[model samples]
Target: MVERLRYPGGLRLLLTPNRSLSWRGNVRIWLLLALVSGIIAGGWALAGVWFILPFAGLELMGVAAGIYVTSRNCQRKEVVTIEGDTIHIESGLNRKEHDWILPVRNTRLESFPPNTPFDCHRVRLANRQQQIPLGDFLNNADTDALVHALKARGINILQTEQQPTVGIWF
Candidate 1:
């Protein structure tokens, strides 16, 4: 998911990974699958294959583990806010947060070539000392839109040709 909000003075851009199922929805689907599997396993157990019960438990645990791993980063997000001369970036994944503050006057947008044929190009905000990647999860179209919005807001984009990635800032 990519969201952009433009204000009178600046703009805010938010990037998040797309999740088809919420955590609750995932739980419900898993539960239903477990129930059906348990019922089938119980039938086999009653037929003297008692080892099926433990295997069923293992299957359930595996399912739970898969869900946990996939959903752990579902709430990850990146936020870029450009207000006046300051640019603020906030990113969080798996409950860990990071922030960066840069001056608009000194900041530059850098574009890198795609690392692989299947990978999109990458974009980053950089200065003399530090650099940060942006819009890691956005598609090509959304990245272009974000760059356009940032350019419209008066930020200097150093390169746009064959740039490797997407990002946004005012």
Candidate 2:
């Protein structure tokens, strides 16, 4: 998901992975699954296989953990701001994990042409001093949209016809 906002000082782009289910919706689905599983486990326990109950509980705990992780990942947000001559990038779930502030004139957008027809382009924000990745969590379509938005905003995007086969970007 992309939200573009205009402020007095600059433009801000809020990027998030496309969400089909809200946090509450996820919880509701989990609850339904848990209730059904719990009932089945209770029935098994009552049939004298009591040990199955503990295993069922453990399985539910593991599933809950997985749900929690997914929820946190889905809640992540990446904020990119362009103000005057500076560009700022902040990424994290609820707090900033990556904070990059660079001069807009020196910074350029670099993307690897998809390595395969099914691959999504890997994008990076780079300057003489540092190269930082952007939109690692976005889908292929969203990534393309991000590249287009950057291009429209007059940010330089490096295009190399050769697809990188083996490389490390720092």
Candidate 3:
């Protein structure tokens, strides 16, 4: 389900199939690929029944591996807590922290999506802000809500300048 799993210092947002976020898209794509490939392999291996069984077994294993990896990476829960002058974000079993007690008086929430299909929820510390990547444990909504809550509490979220351009070759 779409539930907010909160911790002492942060929050975790979870969306899962049969719970919150539907896994239809992921399931559909993978199932289609698996079926198509299985059909092709089966047709070719029909001439050799023994080989067909092994090939089918391998195909199923590959599908299972893909599902395991995708579920492990997506639909995560994150915790963001402010203790003293530092903000700690915990996701999965990993922890990431930022000492915001810098000379910069403001933070920036930039909606930039790199290669990820979903919009990235980033909180950039400004004025010589040192960038730290958050764990892949946070969903888009979780990040946005945390930033908004912080802002409501009088935290200044500043606007960023143009992003640095990167060359494709590089």
Candidate 4:
């Protein structure tokens, strides 16, 4: 479920819903622990154990708050368009924009494993000295095609000598 959220000034962001982080997104182990805690609470409630009900309620509240914060923080509204002088990236509720050089001569796009160092999509993009995850914006096929198009247009994608072992979360 890919939905498009657009803003003024030609800024477009894509929202991919129903995508859960496989074992990788559970960095804090909240989801895993939530399941266990929910079961315990449910069992206790069923057995007329009233005291543990409060603990269960607290845990449930914590999980809900965590999810809300995560969703809000992950709301990175990426804006990619060709302006007269630069390319821009805007994100968050404030919609701040950053301008990169017209031609990012040192930009490189590579496919990296998902949920290795950071929990994100499988593609990694390197521009100048900065690295950003490309998964949030482009799908697998689209990313590959974009890389090829950029390379054909004289954008250099420096390949790394050391290959990284990709992690796949079940």
- The TM-score, computed over Cα atoms with residue i paired to residue i, of candidate 4 is 0.49
Write out the backbone clash pairs for model 3.
1-19, 1-20, 9-80, 9-81, 10-79, 10-80, 11-78, 12-78
- In Å, residue 152's CA in model 4 sits off its true spot by 5.6
Top-scoring candidate (TM-score): 2
Supply the global lDDT for candidate 4: 0.53
lDDT of 3 by residue, 1-170 (tens): 23455656443333232323246766776788878877877787776654666767787778868776666555444444544444544445223322233321344433443333433545543444455444334456655665566565444565444355556643
- Model-by-model lDDT, in order? 0.82, 0.85, 0.51, 0.53
Assess the local accuracy of residue 97 in candidate 1 as a C-alpha lDDT between 0 and 100.
Answer: 90
Candidate 2 C-alpha lDDT tens digits along 60-84: 8898898889888888899999888
- C-alpha TM-scores of all predictions: 0.80, 0.87, 0.49, 0.49
Q: Which ten residues in a row are the worst by lDDT in model 3?
A: 93-102
Model 4 per-residue lDDT tens digits across residues 1-170: 23334545532334332335533564456766778887888798899987897888787788768776666555544444433333444434446544333334455556553434443345545666666554354455555554554455455565444345655642
Which portions of model 2 show Cα errors greater than 4 Å? 116-118, 162-170
The residue pairs that clash in candidate 4, if any, are none
Which scores better on lDDT, 1 or 4? 1
Q: Is candidate 2 or candidate 4 better by TM-score?
A: 2
lDDT of 1 by residue, 1-170 (tens): 66886667778988887788999999999999999998999999999999989989999999999998888867788888899999899999855399999998999887665645676657788999998998877767767777777778677887756534444421
